[model samples]
Target chain A: MSAGVRLEGLRKSYGAVEVIRGVDLDIEPQEFVVFVGPSGCGKSTLLRMIAGLEEITGGDLYIGERRMNDTDASRRGIAMVFQSYALYPHMTVRENMGFALKYAGVKKPEIKAQVDEAARILGLDQLMDRRPKDLSGGQRQRVAIGRAIVRHPEVFLFDEPLSNLDAELRVQMRIEIARLHSELKSTIVYVTHDQVEAMTLADKIVVLRDGRIEQVGTPLDLYDDPDNLFVAGFIGSPKMNFLPAELSGGALTLVEHGGQTVPLPPLGRAPQEGERVTLGIRPEHFRKEGSAALEVDVEIVENLGGETYVYARQAGSDVLTIATGGARGLRQGDRMTARFDPSDALLFNREGLRIR
Target chain B: MSDVAAHRLDPEAAEPSARAALRGPDGPGRDMIGPAVKYIVLSLAAFVSVFPFFWMLVGTTNSSYDIVRGKAWFGDQLLVNLGNLIEQVDLPRVLFNSFYIAIISTVATLLVSSLAGYAFEIFRHKWRERIFAALLLMLSIPFAALMVPLFVMMASAGLINTYSAIILPTIANIFIIFYFRQATKAFPHELRDAAKIDGLKEWQIFLRVYMPVMRSTYAAATIIVFTLTWNNYLWPLIVLQTNDMKTMVLTISSLNSAYTPDFGVIMVATVITTLPTLIIFFLLQRLFVQGMLGSVK
Candidate 1:
């Protein structure tokens, strides 16, 4: 059975340096929540704290209503799959899968039965006799997951589990992990720096920055409506293009892009006139017909068969990425007018706070 | 293109001449000189290393007078030398003493030092590195400098003449501990994490996970500690007051110091003393190579 996890004012520190600063989160039972962040953002640290691998410095951590700050990692009803696969090189796949069960004093036959069931789930029945070194990287990862599954943990924690796999294998394993969560109906807290993995697999994506949760929402919420400049820039692949702007009389003028004025996006609250703000625009939001347009010098054009990305720059401005739907016959040094809807742009204040 | 230009450009056309040039006097044959010199040097080194064993073997089969005359070939004195050495040395009791001390010392040293090494590498604290640095600094202090104090301690404990004096000094071997610490660095920390999550406690992880994973390292340590203990002469000579308690190396030293030393018997004793280390090296040679390279791989 799955159990929910809750962290109340979680704080982790090393001497005077605090890495996790007052993180409070609730993970619903059987929900797949992903902690997504850049490097050194305390995502992995928080996950480790939840799993009881790391000592909770100042926090109340609850796994299914029980305070687990003092509980040992093994007794916390959590299983973790490390990025390195961390399979014991000396143990066979079967032994590795059944290790926790054996240590928990389960009978030999029961251990075998559980291992077999996990193997069947992961399609690892053929490779049970082999050691970790003898198997492929993907196979070794499957064994690691199988090892976690045999214990029937209420919560499964994955710390960048697919970071070590090759690209194709990473996609395959990502799907497999999502399937496993559904089949077992268990709560899972997965950590990854790759926003694509977070977006594809997470029921709720917790965007973290500088050891603090920046925003928490569904994939589209984070993509379409990021809470801040950091989340706006982080979530999407070919990340959201940010342009400097200044509010001027119910419209925003691109400061570096020839003072082109566009109508202000509709918002609950608007910034004061003449205030400097950052404009966030997703690459895919650019369209051939829109109310706003910027004439730019095309620096690079990348054709990916089905779509084309035009990296263009305005005078004294950062290069903007525009995803043209298909091959546009655009070339480097070509002058193009990139167009987008004014309502699609997101505005952030000087402190990087979203204005709306 | 012109035919001559095309010919110059064609790798197929240039192939035969290139092959012929490689097979010519200044090409492939010239490379042979490097290998030839290497073999000559290696053979000289091999002969230099093996000649002492050959001479010792020849001395074992020769009389004292013949050995003194530099006899480099076999003779009929093998059984006589064996008989004389056996008669002089209480073979079974001396073997027991050497084996007992060496085995006990090796096992104890491996257990103690490896545990120390694992702990030194695994645990984290403010003092961990400073204490380890002090231990490393202790490695540079010569054994000769510490021997007098160690002897005094043993003498005060009434252990000077006991086997403890010989075994106790080496149990917490700094060099082996350093070796184990370096090897343990290659030990994946994630395994310990996994074992902890597998419900194994710290000590159980050391035994069930660390020990088996690091067997090659243990085998390598066993060979090293066993050889050092077996061939240990100076320390054993200083502490072992009784002839029965002396190791084989001490016995050999005593034979060498005799007023009228029997060369044949000395050679036989030397061979006997060397056999155990050789046997150990042979048994653990593959694992020793693996351990030295990095046991984790």
Candidate 2:
């Protein structure tokens, strides 16, 4: 049976500086939730608190319907896979998988069966007798996951489980984890700083910054409708670009780009005419030709076979990245015209909060 | 005709004269001389370090008078030295006492220290860290300063002349604790968390998970603690007041102090005292080195 998790105003602090500042979230049963943030943003801390590995400074954690704030990690029916794939170095893969089950009051036969089933799922049947040192990094990671799987936990917690892997192995393991989630249909909470992993594996992504939640939504929801500048900048690769602008007469005019302006749809209320704003645009949203255009000096062009990214400057401000299809003939110091639809732009206030 | 032209045009065919021109004169002998001197120096150091053990073996086969005269080879006095060693001490009992203490102390030290080390590393509480730092400070306090108080404590507990008196005081040793703590820094905390989620309580996790995972560390600690406890002369001499309870080191000390002290017999006793530790080290040498590397990493 599976269970949902509810963290109500969960907070963690060490020596007065709060690492997790009052996080509240309701994770539905069998949903894969990812806590994505930069290092030290307390995403791992929040996951640990839910796993009962870290003590909650304040607020309540409920697994299913039971309050788990004071529950021991084992009693909470949770299993965790760590970034280092902390398999027992001395034990065989089979023993490593069955070690916890031995203490969980499972019969020897049952334990062996469970371990065998987990090994089969992780494709580690041939490596059952091998110690961790004898296995490669991917196999060792599989053993670690198998150790967790044999427990049949109601909730699974993963603390940056694929960070130690190389790029190719990380992608492979990421797919394996997605498949495992679907197969087990268990509620999972995964933490990582890599937004690609977060976007790909998560049923719901919780974007975090400075120990606070920036936004929580589906991956596409976050990409399309970020609630803050941090979320917009963090969720996408190549990151969303921000340019200084001013709101005037239902029009957002780029202040730093030689006064290039775009008319905005009429809002019931408007900020002061000269109020400063941030114009956010994803690199892929930049069009080669459109009704609105901004002339920029191309400083660098990276041709990645299928797509080309142009790093350019408009009116001598921060560099803006524009991703275009196919190989481009753009070169350094070449003047280029970049265009986009007005609807593609995201508007944020001076304080980095989304304005609309 | 074309093949004949290609063979004539070949580089090897054309380079016979150039080969002699490219052969330069021999280089200087400086490089060979450096390694030659280094080998001589290293062999000399090895000789100096190993000479005493060789001398002891030779002395065991010589008469006491001949040994005193610095005789350096085997003689017909081996039987006589063995006889004297047996007469002067209960050799078997003394050897047994040394072994029993070392084995028990090593096992107990590994268990207690590894437990404490794992606890300190896995559990991140304020007081535990403070206690750990305090333990390190305690390690720096010389054992000589605590010996008298420790002796008094043992005497009050009615543990005088008993193996427990010697073993108990050194069981919670700070050095072993510190060694385990350092070794434990390399232990993946993820393993502990995994064990916890696997439904293992603290002690179960320690015994089943931590102990098995840290085998190399335990092996190194066993050698170190065994060597230290087996060669423990002062504490054993002070605590073991009875002749029957005397360890090998204490017996050797007493044998050297006797009137007309038998050098041959003393050599035998020295060999007996040193053999157990050497055996332990030889047995666990690989694990010991591996453990050391793991800790430093």
Candidate 3:
């Protein structure tokens, strides 16, 4: 059975420095939540705090109505898969899965049955007798998962479990994990620095930075409607481009490009006229035909078979990425006109908070 | 150095057998000079280290006069020497005493030292490092310095000539504890965390996960502790007074001090005393190497 987790004002500080600064979240039962951020962003710290592997400096952590702040890690009714896969190197996969149950005084038949069932779920029946060192990285990762699955913890915690695998294996495991989440229907709180993993696996994504939550939303929601500049930049590949602008003459005028102005749609919280702001636009949003257009010189052309990205820049401006058709005959230093709907542009104030 | 240079000038002249025997399938480098030179040096080193044991074994078979005359070959006096050995010492009793003390001391020291080492590493705190530093200091202090007070404590406790007196002082071995502590650092902390999530208590995790994962370390410690306690001479010599309670080491020392010391009998006794340690080292030599590798690395 899955359990809902509620963390209130969760604060963790080491000596004078606070790592997880006052995080509050309500993770629903059976929800697949991912905490994603850059390295040293306190995402893993928050995950470990919930796992009870770390002492909570201050917080109220409730798992299924039980306060877990002071509970021992074993009593937390949780299982974690570490980045290293952390399988007992000396034990066979079967023994590693059944080790805790044996120590817990579970009946021998029950332990065997549980381990076999978990092995079947993880497709590890053939590898049950192999020690961790003998298995390939992906197989060892599955065994690590099987060990956790055998315990049937209420919540599964994964800390960058696929970080060690090669790219192909990581994608395969990512799909497998999504399928497992659906089949098992267990609450999971996964932490990763890889935004792609977060986008693919999470029911809800919690983006964090500097020990604070920047935004929390679904993958598409974060990509489309970021509350701040950090979430907008962190969530998408090819990254959203930012151009410095000043609100003038009823439109945002590019500060770097002289005499260039882009029209803006009516926003819920518009910035003051003549104030400095950042105009945000996703690379894929640029089109060959639209209401707004900008002239740029192509800096680099990346032909990725299906899609080509034109890295272009205006005079006195940073390079801007524009996702264009593959092999459009665009070469470096070629002048191009990129266009997008005015409504597609997201405006952020000088402090980087979203205006709409 | 000249030999190396000579081979380097014409690398094609390298010995095929040396390369074939010494080179691993995917091992680095092409030169046979390194491994060839290594083989010669290692065999010489092995002979140098093992020569004393070889000399003692030769002496065990020779008469005392012939031994003093520096006889190098095996003689026909081994049986007579053993007979003299039995007459000079109650062989069974002393062997039994030594075995009992050694086996018990080794087991106890391993348990105590390994646990301390595991704790100092896994449950690290500021004070643990400070206390560990103090222990390292204790290791540097001569055992001879503590001998008088230790003897006084044993005498006051009415434990003089007892196995407990000989075994007690050697049990809290700082060196072995230091080794275990360093080895424990190499143990994957994530395994401990995973075990915790799997519903194992701290002690259960240590016993089930950490212990099996670190069997190499304990094997190395076993050989080390057993050898140390088995051949421990000075403390046993001073503490054990009665002939019946005497260890093999004390008995050998007693035999050596006699006016007409039976060198052949003493050699036989030394051979008997060293056999168990040699056997232990041989059995766990691989584990000893791995354990040292883990700790030092």
Candidate 4:
């Protein structure tokens, strides 16, 4: 059975320094929500607080209809997969998976049935007799997942579970987790610094920064319509390129690039003349057919067979990543005109808040 | 060819042969001298350490007069000396007393010390490091200073002449607590977190997860504490009054301090006293090495 989580005015502090400052969010039942942020942003701390691993300094936490702020982690009906896997080194896979059940006073045959079912689901049947040390990193992670699965909790918490794996294994396990989530349909809260993992696996993504929520939305919602500069910059793979500009006479002028001008996109409220702003554009948004163009010199070229990313810039200006679709001929020092639609670019005020 | 002619004929061939000659065993660059010195030093140190034990074994076979005369060879007096050792002391009672005290002290010390170590490392509080530093500082105070106070406390409790007095003082050993605290640093804290999530109480986590994971540390501590408790002579000698309560080491010392001491019998008792510690050491030798290196892989 799945249960929803609601956090209201959640706050956590160590001594005088507050780490999770006034966070409020709702995780719907069976919704896979990912908490994404850079290091020291309190995403993991928030997840831990939700899992009852950390005490709430001042807040209300509800799992299903019951308040869970003071509940023990085990009693909260939640299972957490740690970053280190956290498997017991001395126990075999079977014993490790069944340890909780054994301690919970489950009968021997019932514990065996549950552990065996989890093992089958995770494809850990052959490895049941092996200790954690004897298994590969991927296998150990699967056993950790199996250990959690055998609990059959209402909510699942994952704390960067695939971060310790190699890239290929990470992708493999990511798909495995997605498939598991789909099968079990349990409310899951996952924490990760990797934006790609958040974007790919999350039904809803919560962007946190410096102990506060920047924005919370569906993956595409955050990507297409970010509420702030931080969420816009953090949610994408190749970071959005920002150009310092001034809104003068209804047109934006690039201050650092010799006054190159582009028409400002229509906004809900008109900005003041001579208002300083930042224009953000994604690398892939630079299309050949767009109306606006910037003449620049290519400094470096990175070709990954399918798409090439050219790092180019004007003289005395910051470099911008431009995605050249299958243009293999571009090389360093090649002068080119990168173009994009004016409507696709976003503007931010000087305070790093989105203008529209 | 002459050296100059060979170099002139083929520079590549000449250079390789010259390099090989310098690297060869008999060459000036050969590294034999340092290793030879090291081996010589090591052999001498080994002999210095082992000669006393060898002399002890030989003393057991020789008579008292021969031992005093510095007789180095084995004689046929082993059975006689063993018989005399058995007659002078109740061998079974002393042996039982030593074993009982050592085993109980070892088990209790490991439990109490490891729990303290684990708690010190895992739990957070304002006074944790201050308390630990104070404990470590207490280690610098010589046990001789505490012996009188400890004896007085034991006497007040009416615990003197009791095994409880022997076992109780050693249970909270600071040195072992330090060792376990250091080893517990290597323990993965995530396991504790996982056990908590799995619904284990703190003590249950210690008994089920920590104890098994830190078995190497336990093994090493067992050998050390067992040896120390078994070889403990002064405290037991002072507290234990009756002949029936004497430990093997105490009895051996008493035999040595007699008006007319028998060296052969003393040597036999010494051999017997040394055997249990040796057996424990050998049994836990591998794990002890691993524990000294690190408890967790």
- State fnat for each of the candidate structures: 0.81, 0.94, 0.92, 0.78
Candidate 3 segments exceeding 4 Å error: B1-44, B295-297
- lDDT by residue for model 2 over A1-356, one digit each (tens)? 67999989888888889988888899999999999988889898898888887889998999999999898898998889998887877778898899878877889999999999998999999999988889888888888889889989899999999988989999999999999999999999999989889999999999888888889999999999898898999989899999888988768888888787876533335667889988888999889666668889998899999989999997667899999879578899999888887678788888898877
Tens-place lDDT per residue, model 3, A1-356, is 99999999999998889999999999999999999998899999899999998889987999989999999887888988999998888889999999878877899999999999999998998988888879999998898888889888899999999999999999999999999999999999999988889989999999999999999999999999999999988889989999899988788898887759989756976677899999999999899889889999999999999999999998988889999966579988899999988799899998999997
Candidate 3 similarity to native, TM-score: 0.91
TM for candidate 1 is 0.95
- iRMS, all models: 0.7, 1.2, 1.4, 0.8
Ranking by DockQ, best first? 1, 4, 2, 3
In candidate 3 chain A, what residue range of length 10 has the lowest lDDT sum? A264-273
CA-lDDT, candidates in order: 0.92, 0.86, 0.90, 0.93
Give me the runs in candidate 4 sitting further than 4 Å from their true place. B1-30
Better of 1 and 2 by lDDT: 1
Model 2 clash pairs?
none
Query: Per-residue error at B211 for model 2, in Å?
Result: 1.8
Supply candidate 3's per-residue lDDT for B193: 89
Return the lDDT, model 2, position A303: 97
lDDT by residue (tens digit), candidate 3, B168-276? 8877889988998889889989888888877778887888888888988998999989998998898888888889999998888999999999899999999999999
lDDT of 1: 0.92
Model 1: how far is A85 from its true place, Å? 1.1
What is the C-alpha lDDT profile of model 2 across B93-180, one tens digit per residue?
Answer: 9888888888898888878877777777776786987898888888777879988999999999999999998889778877788888
